[model samples]
Target chain A: MSAINGQSTNGSTAAPGTPRTGGEVVCDAMLAAGVDVIFGMPGGASLPFYDSLYHYQDRIRHVLIRHEQAAGFAANGYARATGKVGVATSTSGPGATNMVTCMANDIMDSVGVVYITGQVARPAIGSDAFQEADVTGISIPITKHSYLVMDVDDLPRVMSEAFHLASTGRPGPVHVDIPKDVFLETTTETAPDQVNLRGYRPSKVGNARMVRKAAEVINAAERPIIMAGHGIDISGAADELMQLATRGSIPVVSTLHGVGTFPETHPLSFGMLGMHGLAYANFSMRQTDCIIGLGTRFDDRAVGKEDEFGPGAKVVHIDIDPAEIGKVLETDVPIVGDLKLTLQKLLPLIESRDRTPWLDQMNGWRRDHPSLKIPDSPDSVLPQEVVRAIYDISGGEARVIADVGQNQMWASQHFWYERPRMFFSAGGLGPMGYALPAAMGVKLADEKQDVWCVTGDGGLLINIQEFNTLAAEGINVKVAVLNNAHLGMIRQWQEFFYEGRYMGAFLDNPDFAKVAQAFGLHGVGTSSRDEMHEAIAMAHEYDGPVVLDLHVDRVENVYPMIVPGTGVNSVIEDPR
Target chain B: MNGTETHTLVATVADHPGVLTRVASLFRRRGFNIASLAVGHSEEPGYSRMTIAVEGSAEEVKQCEKQLYKLVEVVSVRNLTGAPAVTRELAMIKVRVTSNERPGLAEITDIFRGEIVDVSKTSMIVQMTGAQSKIDRFLDVITEYPIEEISRTGVIAIARDDVGPRNGRARG
Candidate 1:
């Protein structure tokens, strides 16, 4: 099959003069859109779609996940990792509702995904039929666009539009809800050759005047820093970002999602910035004269106490979404265009300058602060060390997907990502139990790449049922459960903000290794630092899935923290 | 008008299902309060024009405009806040009035260029069409009598002459 405009041409499933089922039309559409895999589960409403899947299994590989939420996260993980439109599906009502959190996560993180949900029959849609839910209505706020297909003939166009909208500028999740009967209805329609949405044209080229203004700002700045964000990865502008940074001798600070866009090993890299970010990186915000915010929204987490953040710095905000510019902070030069194109235009005009004094100043701060220290403890292993050990063993090559909360911070802080899409986490929504299932998608996306799921005891248990799926599918993803036996982040907050009154922060965790073993996967439990490295190695060596549960210190908190509602200047380093 | 806390914005959008909900939801989610919103079919066959009066700072309203443009159904948005735009509202007030008091009420309606659309033995319904402020004044003048109910089709607006249609193009 030849490819044109990134879509495969082998889209027709029905022979000439033969009618095609709506489900087959959907299959043809997916093939046309170049969808090679889908993460989903079967249900009553989606039986016909599954029946069609049975026929098209040769072209599209379907992974039957344990839960709809896992299916959505897995699809999201696939999208984040590959920069393609990941697909997930489910039946009506409960199945559709289960995917809402993942949709929210995808939207928040700007991930491109297409969620195909089966609905009640068209006639029974408004009658409150059994297993029916208003999927499109529920998804309106969370998705980039949503459609409730009433006509079976519109399937091809809707599928094409869904993929187009999902993967376009400022990528986000697009949903298509189809009636159960519609999927079974016969049609001769084929996938559309083009998608024409009059109201949905995204800007690609930067305005020449604004790009010039931004270039002028960059050229004039004596001490400037590049705040690279998820947009860099989304637009595939990492090379452009590096060129701009290197040309101007500018320091680079990454938002959590922006990690790995610029190689952390580079001297210009200042590491992740925000709450739970590097102290030196957060501190650098105060002294910088210009903030070249590329593809970042300057989220509240990234810019703490917005009014007090970068009080004197001139902000040059460049984003594909016009709404994101000047939405959070006042931007001096707001460039609304694709980051890659805008940077290309801005680079040549940016005059080269040596910022040795600024670099030396940040280096001094890095020396003094020195975050990511592994505490020495004989009785319990530190989760930070576990992440460090994974980075060391994998040689910083594994795609590390971290579950939310304390474990997420530990992974972001310790593991140095050298390439884009190497580190995946629930950055915007902060959903727990994302790693295990997301890792499944990442590993499936690229079988040669080693994948690791670093999760906390609290987060791991949320989607622990996926161990059965892993065992059944034989996905070789290594898992590291940081078992603190508490909702570590909540506990840390309770100790600091709530005056030590722990309310529902403690958890009596089960033996995760035993749980994995019961699911027919390799499992190992390690409580001491001595056993941690060997256990990680054992999990890495296992051909199939393996869960290595590391019992870390119960009270250890992620530090270099900015107190909630505080500014970047007021950073609280590890007291110990 | 540019400095005013409340601004009026006009958006041209596709006349598609749930588009109104999407627009209303964007306002609610973005924390921008909508003072009034009037939507109807535009000169274009399949598109609708929405006149939205929102309350916020200039920057906040600008952000609201940008967010509205983010909607796939919304083709374009024009902030008619400081522009020379023709704006009007239609209001119907059903008031409790005696046969004797009806004469005075009729006079008040006539003074405001409004008409008594309906009249009963002890009640009268006045239909008024004008600027929001004119309708507010008419309501205040009629408040001397016992009030019954009020129905308002919120403000709808369009740019005046010489200001070309900034309807379809997205502003940076």
Candidate 2:
């Protein structure tokens, strides 16, 4: 067959009228690879991939999101929900640049996602080809691996490799950049084989000696606390975490990103630690003799200054990434591997010992903080009250996807999640519009579970376009938008640190309820605490997407603020 | 050629774009000119790597390896100094020379058992394969002439078929 453009589009015999080209092969390969949906916003370079999507309409669903950035988040949600590889497609330049944040989110959270973007034709490559950006180069820091497929023959292999890499080990996003010509080229090579990445391999288990050392510390310690992080959930090690916690009778104090690793209702579980963390959880961590740190990056927020974060505690950090061991607080022992596997091994070696004094102390702190109390401030609805309602209705057992800002803080402090990984939030990136799409990812990851996308009004507006993606894909995700007219979290910071300099913070948003209705999903508006429970219950029962626009106190702050640089003692204690 | 040493390293990364740049930057910034470095596809598409290499010496390379792991993308690092291992490097050298320099090139090539890939009126590009020493020796001899450009395939090696890194021993 002759090469045309670079795709193998000419050799296949066409019926009397139907013309088969290189585009068809790619579409066929994409279908064969089990890609049902692709989220993207199109442009000139990606016309060929779009052309292929046109050919395979029913087989592959292409969702045209409002922005390319949202496309990446939507795909991430799809991947998180389905356990299948999430795929996002976009054209070059800004379309590709918009994907960086989402890609970084996947890298940080370890979500399996495959990103495809069209590059300018090979001939136009280095000339700063119109709309041509070095996507492969730009994404290297955030992807597992990336490929710039210059030749059409390399597409199948590159794509196969991209998907393979994205789905394995610590699942993450990978990019495959195809030039315009390559997307349209004709090729002679057969369908590409699953390229074996010879150098890539993830160690399934931790070093035995390290695991044994971790166990020794835990077993010997008079009071051991398990500080869980996002790694535990990303690795699907929740079961192992629970097993270890149960077997060892160890108490757990989770970081904000670490919530949902263990059920909040569990007797030993103290939800979230830090400035805003429950007084009991922070106190528990401070007093513990040994800290079994798993899957949690001891970000400064989790542990105020390294010295006082967990003072007097010997931290045995068990993380997949070894550098995190002593990067902050010195680690007495470091176990590197899948959190579940390491915990599974250490579970057997640990001895059950009750830390009655420690538990009593933690209980006392819990009593002191007593969670947040939502005072009726004028007509402003409290976000904390809504979370308590959801917990009351669902018993806090279902999965909760808390969007950024006050909604995230409220969900983190209020919603009681018993399992890890279920509480998905944009922790490292702290992207404002992360919750809804991530909630969609979480819901799709486990459909049977009740998934609530707890978001704020400002953040919800950023990716509200994905409501179309969610509705069209038939994903049952519940969205609770804490409709405070301002960007709650940033507003809080501005109120405290920046001296109330709003500056693009307060967001005048659309009627989110109507927006949901427009997308053919259920939409509800809540202004009172009494009505919040019934609304959440109604939304949860609906078999499709639903949005609850909650009117919350515009100035309500996530309290117990720990001024940065100051140790734990500097925490603002006035509840007023 | 001067005496050479080898060191192994491991790093944990955020598994994002430009991580390779961060990895490559370590060598460039530290001024530990990397003789060769190769990154393999990772098992957890976005995790860490047991990156093994041989450069500098036991002490210098070890120090460099530790710093490499400290880079932001780098999660952690370890140097297998006295551990069982294997090492290899791939290089493609295109040397420049006149007709008169052919014999010297050939004589030197013959000593190293190298192959001539291309021959032109002014220069002949010789391809050599071996440890860092063999390639270094060929380049050192050819440096006397107008050396146009040199392209080297960075080093990629697995421990000599024995114990598989650190994880293998744990299974036994």
Query: What are the per-model DockQ values?
Result: 0.75, 0.07
Whole-model lDDT per candidate:
0.89, 0.73
**TM-score (0 to 1) of chain B, per candidate?**
0.91, 0.60
Q: Whose DockQ is greatest here?
A: 1
Residue lDDT tens for model 1, A243-292: 99999999999999999999998999999999989999998998888999
Candidate 1 TM-score for chain A = 0.97
- The CAPRI category of model 1 is medium
Query: What does TM-score give for chain A of every model?
Result: 0.97, 0.88
Worst 10-residue stretch by lDDT in candidate 1 chain B? B163-172
Worst 10 residues of 1 chain A by lDDT: A1-10
| Model 2, runs deviating above 4 Å | A1-35, A54-59, A186-195, A376-378, A395-398, A442-450, A467-476, A499-504, A514-526, A531-534, A541-544, A573-576, B1-22, B25-172
Per-residue lDDT for A222-244 in model 2, tens only?
87899888777677888888888
Runs in model 1 lying further than 4 Å from the true structure: A1-18, B1-4, B163-172
